[model samples]
Target: MLTPIPLLIIPLAIYNIIAFLTPGVAWTSGLAEIAMMSGVRWTLTVSDVFLALCLFVLLFEVMKATRISSRSIVDHILSLLLFVCALIEFLMVPQAGTSPFALLVAIMLLDVIIGFSVSIRVAQRDVALTAAPDQ
Candidate 1:
């Protein structure tokens, strides 16, 4: 179960390597350009980065839930925030051109929803674990 975290690391590490190797597709600038083309106002902001970080943290929390404990308060709060930010971003994306902003926001929205579901499941599991055993 704990192996899942390390399994995820492989793909993440591969992505990092590919990103580093591809200088032509500079991730941040490409993302900004896609946002601009799609008419997403102010897509590149500190809030976006913060939301990404929050998603990463949520992923870790989910991994932890699979192995050991249930979802924590921090996980739930972060996931909720991620969902909110994604919704705002999605709603703000203008219908002009091929804006990847909408796509990105959609991905974030999915992640947040999944995180929330996992949190609820974890909470239920926690309750079950804490219940007194029958005589």
Candidate 2:
């Protein structure tokens, strides 16, 4: 049995990692496909849902980076690499230009930027406090 936090975090982390690591193809990946008919008919795939999940996770990461009191350099650096990898995949990989993963990459980049910016401000404030004597 896993604790609540790890239970929630682990699956999402794995999903993001797998999604990032897996090679892209002529089409997006998904678990299931849905058929719809309205004037015309089309199949909507799980990749659409994955995009929503990615966006939700991105929101979580950004908020966590901003709200968490402790800042880890390694975490931010890894986020940078994540962003870079996604960017490279988008530019170089086949069919990625038409996929949602490109948006995920952009979100990762924003997360890195915001996380570093907030961490720097927090560090500066801490330095000011530590340097000042009790007054």
TM-score of 1: 0.38
> Candidate 2 residues 1-135, lDDT tens each?
211121123323544555567645223444554455555445455566656666676666655554444335656766777667667767886545644566566667677888789888767766743466788
| TM-score against truth, every candidate | 0.38, 0.56
Worst 10 residues of 2 by lDDT: 1-10
Give the C-alpha lDDT of model 1: 0.47
Q: How close to the true structure is residue 24 of candidate 2, measured as C-alpha lDDT?
A: 52
Best by TM-score: 2
For residues 1-135, could you state the per-residue lDDT of candidate 1 as single tens digits? 333232222333333343456534433442342346667766454335534654575476556534334324444455456557545644663331123344445444555566567667756776754668899
Q: Which stretches of candidate 1 lie over 4 Å from their true place?
A: 1-71, 93-99, 129-135
Residue 54 Cα positional deviation in candidate 2, in Å, after optimal superposition: 1.2
Clashing pairs counted in every model: 1, 0
lDDT values for all models:
0.47, 0.57
